[model samples]
Target: MLIKQIIIRKKAQEIEKKSPYILLFHCSGLTSRQWRQLKNILCTFQGRTLFQPSCRGKLPYKKKQGGFIAQFAFSAGPTCILYLIRKTPDNTWSQLLPSAFYKQNLVLLYGQLQSTLVNHMDIKRAVDLETVSVFQQLFELIFYPYNSLCFCLNQPIQAE
Candidate 1:
C-alpha cells in the first residue's frame, strides 16, 4: 500500500506540473503578504498553479513593472498572463489600461476575481486554447514572424 501511494503521489505531481499556471499580480498598495490568505484558498485546487511575487523593491529590469511580467513570462512560459485586478472608487471596474508589450499574452480584467467580470476557471480555459484575441490590431508573431497570424497562445513563447 505504501508503494502504491507513493506512485500515485508522483503521478499527481507530474500532472500538476503540466497543468496551466496563473500568476495573480497584486496591484498598487498590495504585496505578496496580502495574497497569503488568498493564495491558500486558491492554490488548494490541482487544476493550476498560482504565483504572487513581492512587488516591494526595485528590480533589475529597466521597468519595475516588467519584473513581475518577466517572472510570469519565464516561469509560466508563453501561456502565462499577468492579471491586473483593479477596483475603482465608483464600484465599477476600470477598463482603460496603458499599452504594454509582453512575450506572451496580456489580459485586462476589470473588477475583483470572485466578483462579476471574471472567475478563475474562465482564465484557465482561455489560455489552454490555441488561438486567442489580442484586444487590438498589430499582431506580431513572436516565434515565426513570417508564418501567419494564427499563433498558438497555449504553447510556450520563450524569449530568444
Candidate 2:
C-alpha cells in the first residue's frame, strides 16, 4: 500500500508539466530534501528553471518555505517588485485586487482569522496555523518591496 501511494504521488508530480504557471507553495516544516523529487522531475524539461535559492541549512531563522518560490519569481529577469500573499483567498488567485482590497486581504491572509481557509483545511489545525504564521513572516521580510505582483493560493473545502 505504501508503495502504491508513493507511485501515485510520483505519477501526479510527473504529469503536472502542462501548467507552467502553477504556484507551488511548500507546506512548512518540510525541508528542501522533500523537494528533491520535484527538482529531479523538473530537470528533464528544457527552458524551465527550477531555482531553490534558500535551503536554510544552518540559517538563523527556522526552516520554513515561502520566499523560495517568490525569490525565484523575483530573480526571473523581471523589472517590477512583488509581494507574496501566503494566506490569501482563492479568489485573489484568479483576479487583480483594488488598493483597499489589497491592503485588507494582505492583513487577512497574514492574520489568524477564523474565516480563512487555513482554519478549515483538511490538515491539522495546529500545523496549518504555524505554517500560515511562518509563511506570513518570511514572505514579508524576504519578498517585500516586490509588490509588482501579489500572489495568494487558497484551497477551500465545501462544508456539506
Candidate 3:
C-alpha cells in the first residue's frame, strides 16, 4: 500500500506543472512530519506554491500546541516567507492584522468558520448557539481581513 501510494504521488508530481492552484485540506490532528511530507509532495509535483496552516489544537506527539504557529503561502519564486501566528491559551482571539505583507500569493483558509466565509453557507444560519464563547473567537480569526478567498475541506471523522 505504501509503495503504491508513493508511486501514485510521483506520477501526480510529474503532472502538477499544468495546474494553476492546488488546494489541499487535512484534518486537525496531523503531525508536523505528515504536514511536511504533504507540503514537499505538493511543492515537488505542483511546481507552483503551497501553504499549510496549523490547527487550533496541538498535533498529536507535539510538545507545545499554541505558540509560534507556522503558516505558509507560496508563489512561483525562489523566496518564501513563513507567516507565524501565536495562539493564546486564554481563548482570546488576537487579530493578525493584515498588512501589505500578504498582498500576493493566493490565500487558502481552512477551519469551520472558513466554510461560511468562502461559500457563504453559514452553519450558524442553520444552528443557533445560546452561550457561544469559543465560537466567537473562531469566527474572529476566520472572518479577519486578507482572508477573502478561504476554502474549507470537509472534516473527516478520523484523522488521516
Candidate 4:
C-alpha cells in the first residue's frame, strides 16, 4: 500500500473552501531533508496545514503502523516507497486519469511491492507464501479502485 506518487486531477491552487484538503503524509523513512518535494506539493495547495508529531522507532512496525498507513508504506524493513492519495468528488476522478493508469501506475507499483517483499523476508519460512498472498490482499484493501472517487464515471458530471 505504498503511495509512490500523487496524481491530483486538479491544480493545487484550485482547491477552494468547498474542496477537500490534500494532506500529505511523509513517512518516517523519509528524512527531514528529503521533504522538499512534499513541501512543494503542499505549497501548490496554498500551504494550509495541521501538525501531528511522530518519531521513528528502531524496531520498525513496533511503533509506526499509523505512520505507515498514512503514507501507505510498510514499516517492516529498509525498503521504502513514495506514495500519495487523491480526494475528488468521485465523478471527475477517473475521467481525469489516463486510460492506462491502473496498468501503468498500479500494476507497476504492485510489482515493486512484491520485489521488495522478497528482499525483506526469509523466503525459507513456510508462511512466506501466505504472507505474500496476504500482502496482495491488504494492498488491495488500501488501494482498491472501487474505493476511489473515479471508480465509475462514464457519465458526465452535471453542472450545478
- Maximum-lDDT candidate: 2
Candidate achieving the largest TM-score: 3
lDDT of model 4 at position 152: 18
TM-score each candidate: 0.24, 0.28, 0.29, 0.23
Can you list the residue pairs that collide in candidate 1?
none
Q: What is the lDDT of residue 44 in candidate 2?
A: 45
Model 1 over residues 1-160: C-alpha lDDT tens digits? 3454344345334433442222332222223333333344344445433433334576555365545434433332122223233222332212212232323334322222322222222322222212122433313322232222222222334322
- Against the correct fold, how does model 4 do in TM-score? 0.23
User: Taking the tens digit of each residue's C-alpha lDDT, what string does model 3 give over 46-148?
Assistant: 3243433435775543454423322221111111122222222332223232331233222322323422322221212212111111111323334442232
- For candidate 2, the 10 contiguous residues with the lowest summed lDDT are 119-128
Task: Supply the global lDDT for candidate 1.
Answer: 0.32
Question: Residues 40-140, candidate 2, lDDT per residue (tens digit)?
Answer: 44444444444333344654323455444433322323221122322344454244234323333232212123555422211112222211211234345
- Between candidates 3 and 4, the one scoring higher on lDDT is 3
> Candidate 4 lDDT, tens digit per residue, 56-91?
554344465444333423332232222223433434
> Order of all candidates by TM-score, from best down to worst?
3, 2, 1, 4
Give the Cα-based TM-score of candidate 1 against the true structure.
0.24
- For every model shown, the clashing-pair count is 0, 5, 1, 5
lDDT, model 2, position 85: 22
